[model samples]
Target: MGSSLFSIGLTGLNAAQAGLVTTSHNISNAGTAGYSRQSTVQSTNPGLFTGAGFFGEGTKVDTIKRAYNGFLTNQVLSAETKLNEYDTYSTEISQIDNMLADPAVGLTPAVASFFEGVQEVAANPSSVPARQSMISTAQSLVARFQNLSQRLNDVRAGVESQIKDTVTSIGTYAKEIAELNHKIAVAQQAGSAQPANDLLDTRDQLIKELNQLTRVSTTTATDGSMSVFIGTGQPLVVGTNATTLAAQSSRSDPSRNDVNIITQSGAAITIPENLLGGGKLGGLLAMRSSSLDTAQNQLGLIAVGMSTTFNAQHLLGQDLNGNPGTNFFTPPTVGVQRFSDASTASPQVDFADVSKLSGDDYKLTFTNTTGGYSLTRISDGASVTAANIGLSITPAATSTVGDSFMILPTRNAAANIGVSISDTRMVAAAAPIASAATSGNLGTASISAPVVSSTTDLASFGTAAAPLKLTYSSGNISGFPATLPVTYTPLSGSPITLAAPVASVPYSSGMSIAVGGVSFTLSGAMQDQDSFTLGPNAGGVSDSRNAVQLGNLQTTKTLLSANGSPSATFQSVYSQTVSAVGNKAREVKVNRDAQESLVNQATQAQQSVAGVNLDEEAANLIRYQQAYQAAGKVMNIASKLFDQVLALGQ
Candidate 1:
């Protein structure tokens, strides 16, 4: 009986000691991150069989378990990932918002300055100083474009570098997590399937860290292992194996980086960027596509529109040196990239009509269709009509099915724009053609100055030797180009075509007529015979007709037709870009703030279940200490009884 009492006392003592040890451990690690509160599970030892039925023998520890709630923990993780995504996106796009909206570095001020210079020249076309000032302003505009382009290029470089670094970090986390899985499984198997609480906490912490870089999904196996997946269910880790994430150059454009995953069999598969969402990586890519690319492309759009239209009008004008103007700015080239496995059917861009150009990237996919290729605008995922883009595509015989090409029309136009003419004498300020009624005319009929528009389909206009002549007789105009047709636009009607050999036409008081490319207006009464002469503007130094046309381009709606309007001017396009980025930045920031609040709520809930509490641990410590002392006292009493029994035996 004494031996039984002593054994029970010792068992109680051991159980109490265990409880004390656990409580002390909890208190020590109270401030540790990710430390869960642990508790000792006790059960009565198997009672000894006796005549008094089964009597309670002692207590024994069953297991050491942690206080945890998986549901709350996962909620925290989900909220954390979304918050990080919005935060990263907001931070990145705000830079663009600030730069684009700022007047100091923005295109608005530079554009205004440039057109103002043009107006000054129009006010004084014969002044070389004014023309030189226009050139200076143009160079300033070019420098601004280059500066903006370089800044965007720098941002792109930073994004790529961040992607690569993030991939490396994710790779490291995945590898370490896989190793931990092996360790955990081994420990669980060796320890009789008991829970490894500390290891589990460490693993969860690692996952939280990984989520900061990229979002991930997880599943636990029965063998205490886990599987991690990302980007449309692509497995990143299974059991003890970790897949490798590689940051490689894109096949379509070697200058750009793309993410790929090396599988278990070592086959690499490129993960679509859109599929990798809800993390820092996703935020960087979103900023690149939505804000950075659009701003740069829009800037280039303004560059292309201004350069092409201005050059066209300048070429139709006569300079101070009595020479036709050359290009005011260098022509912008369309950017294209071919896929690696695509056929060698190189696509070419024909800029026959600059008005139809857009600030969107296009993808050309060749198939077995009648035209053998389809064009899609990448921005809105819409098919681009030939008339809408105003570009003709002719497929080569060598073109094969599945051939793909990326066309970037205005991607680099800003960077490529430069002044083509350096001499101020190259400024075309006079109209190329001049019109006057013959001196022999007797009627009150007079001709307006020719407004030469197009240079195509027309030969050299009137010169000193042979002036193109027109006659007004019987209220009908005659003497148009004999071999060419004419286009006439009535004052209240659309333009109509007249067949070649246009002998005569009954004229109205205010009639517009086009012979070849030159258009002129005829108004006033005509006599029996009145003749008009059309000739080149020779030595007209004070003519500012072309300068006025150039200045007028500032407000002309020639670009950004795709941005919710039929046409938009340069300043409007830039302003729209700024507004879009600013709006997006504000939106993302709001979402981030909301998500952060949700994260805080979820974290607090998770901590309530798993986090160690010093106050509770202290109470447990005292309770177990008292139990330990009482157990020792019981053992002491049992020792005295056992000693008395021994004495009786002696």
Candidate 2:
């Protein structure tokens, strides 16, 4: 009986020692990151069988179980990922908001200044100082465009660098997680009843870190290994193997970087930008492809619209030298067209009408062999019929079916926009042609200002066939040679006449007429022998009619067919872009705040389950120490009883 008591006492002592050690360990590592509180699991040893029921033996330690909840861990990871996503998105969009809305340095002031200068030139058409000021303002406007475009490109470059760094970090995390998976599986298999709790905690911590960079979904296998996936179930880690991710330049746009997974055999699988959502990397990718890209393109659209419309109208007027005005601002080009297939004939694309531009990239594909083509606007995935928009795509006669071309209309327009003419004298401020009656005319007949109805008329003015004479007759105007086929519209007849007889129109007071593509009004009573001369304006330095029209372009609906709207002005489009970015930034900030709150709640819940508590551990330490002392006392009593029995025998 004494021997059995001693044995039970020793067993109790061993179990109590283990409990004390575990409690002390918990107290020591309470502040350690990723450390789960451990407790000693005790089980009573099988009681010895006796005729009078079973006699109790002693307690034995079963295992040390870690405090953990898988569900709560997953919740923490999800919340962390969402918070990172919105935080990153908000940070990126704020840069653009500040750029576009800035008072002193933004495009708004430059636009207003440029138009104000144009108005000044209209107020003083013959003043060289006013024209010079107009030129200076135009140059300043171009500089603003170039500076803003470069800043946006810089932002893009920064995003690319961040993406590359993020990809590297993700790859490192994946490889490390895979290595931990191997270690964990081996340890769990070797120690079957007791899992490798500390290793599991380390692995979970690494997954949380990875979630901060990009969203990841995890699955535990039966063998105690984890599999991680990202971006639409692309495997990042599977058991002991991990796939690496690389940041590569995009195929279509070399300036942009795209993410691709590198397989074990060194094969790359490109991940679409849209599929990547939730976390820092997701935010950066979304900003680059959607918000940032849209902002830059919209700015380019404003530049293209203003430059093209102003230049076209400027060309319609006469300059100080009595010559037609040249292009005032450099026109934006349809950036390097990329073709999907080889074709002998390439299509030429130009902005035929600024009012019809939608500021979207396009894809042109030949549908059939008979010169039929289909154009698709990439922004909203809207199909653009040839007749609907002003983009002119002239395909080569040899262009066959299956030929495809990518057209980026406004992507790089702002960067390429510049001042085409440096001389202020080239600024058109006068009408190309001036109408007048001869000084020796016999009648009170007078002519209105000549309007060049078409580019054909402007080019033909002052030519060998121009400066034609018109002699009034009894009932009709004569002097137009009958041999030459002429287009004449009577006062009350059809609006258009193709090659009609010159004398077919009946003369009337206040009659409108068009000859050789020029339109003018011949009003007042005319004598039978009255004559008028139609010629180009040789000196128009004092004229400001064209300058007035140029100034009017500021409020004109130049950017057209945007979002199904018939037209939009330069300021309206830019304002819309600014509003969009501001709204997105605010939205992201609110979402980030909400997500952070959720993360905090999840962390607290997780901590309650697995975190160490000093007060609880201290109590456990005291209890285990007392139990150990009592077990030792029991052993001492057993020893005393054994000594008395031996003395009795002696």
Total backbone collisions for each predicted model: 0, 0
The sequence of per-residue lDDT tens digits that candidate 1 reaches over residues 405-520 is 88887888899999987899989988877888888888776788887787664354557557788898887888887777888877787888889889987777778998877889
The list of candidate 2 runs beyond 4 A from truth reads 337-347, 363-375, 379-389, 395-405, 437-453, 459-534, 562-566
Candidate 1, residue 280: the lDDT equals 89
On a 0 to 100 scale, what is the lDDT of residue 586 in model 1? 93
Quick one: best TM-score, which candidate?
A: 1
* RMSD to the hidden true structure, all candidates: 2.4, 3.8
TM-scores for candidates 1 onward, in order: 0.94, 0.88
- lDDT of candidates 1 onward, in order: 0.85, 0.83
